[model samples]
Target: MKTVAVIDYGMGNLHSASKALEHVADRNTRVVVTCDPETILQADRVVLPGVGAIRDCMAEIRRRGVDDVVRQVVASERPLLGICVGMQVMLNHSEENGGVECLGLMSGNVKFFGRNLKDAAGNKLKVPHMGWSMVDQHQPHALWQGIEKNARFYFVHSYHAHAVDDEVAVGRCDYGVNFDVALAKGTVFAVQFHPEKSAANGLRLLENFLQWSP
Candidate 1:
């Protein structure tokens, strides 16, 4: 049985993520929603979930002194996943909240959507990029296992990740501009979409993560 640590920094919703994972992976998997560094380090996997500003998330992580625990967990090559704003923390930097530094687990920058940007249909779109959107897989990744082409997932992010190397980009979504919707490198995998809120596709995504080897 694999224990997944659902990192609780008091930044975003926790029950939704835990419940979704529990449903997909079954009761054998334990979901630890906590800010405790010790528990996070001891867990077999980590899932960072958030829905607040980047600065606040970072601050909470630092305040709890779990930043190093996150680094250690990823350094050990164990599984680690980040969702939405949680995914943004995996980048090197973010332009939001007056420019703040991120966890640096992945070499990338997070940027916001343009206000005047239009979709491929030439219609003006909203900034937050809310509601259900399509995620196109750009590369083979366990995080996307069993996922079909043009699968729609729930998203509520205003910013997107720009990986320094496009190879790490496993999925992309278009919103005025094409953004790095998902990222994967070694044991570290993250998505800008909220899998817990993405329905069956999201559950399969979590199931895939549970099935991921190394």
Candidate 2:
């Protein structure tokens, strides 16, 4: 049976994420929400999810030794997915919390949306970038399979990733400014939006992830 471990370091909306995964996982698949390193490392796939401040999230991740587990999983090249703050922490650094160092698994930086921001219409936009936004697919990735090109995904973040290499950026979105919304490198796939809250399109993405080979 395939197993997918949802890493629980005390920061993510574990219930929602696990439920969504469970709903889409095949009948033989088992979805586990756990903090145990052994269980996470042994699972067929790993999901890093968070929905809080980067400082607190990183603190818990490191404190619980999940950081090392994440690194190990990435090294294994097993299918891995990161959501929201989960995605941000994959970068080298973040402007949040004045500034916080991250896992540096990927060469990039997390930046704030800034106070002075305006939309294409010259209208002021809010921080956190709440609500749904179009996710423009940049390249053909397994995660994007079955998902429409420019499908709207739920987003609620104040900071976004800026990958050093654009080649890893598989999805892009625009708030007041364009930013990398989804990144794909090797077996890792991360997104700034909440797939569980994205309705049909979101569920399709999760289902695709479950069936994705790499």
- Index of the highest-TM-score prediction: 2
The clash tally of candidate 2 reads 0
Candidate 2 regions off by >4 Å? none
Worst 10 residues of 1 by lDDT: 26-35
Runs with alpha carbons beyond 4 Å of true place in candidate 1: none
Candidate 2's TM-score reads 0.98
Clash pairs, candidate 2, are none
Score candidate 1 by lDDT. Answer: 0.87
What is the Cα-based lDDT of residue 110 in candidate 1? 94
Expressed as tens digits, the lDDT of each residue in 171-192 for candidate 2 is 9998888899899888899999
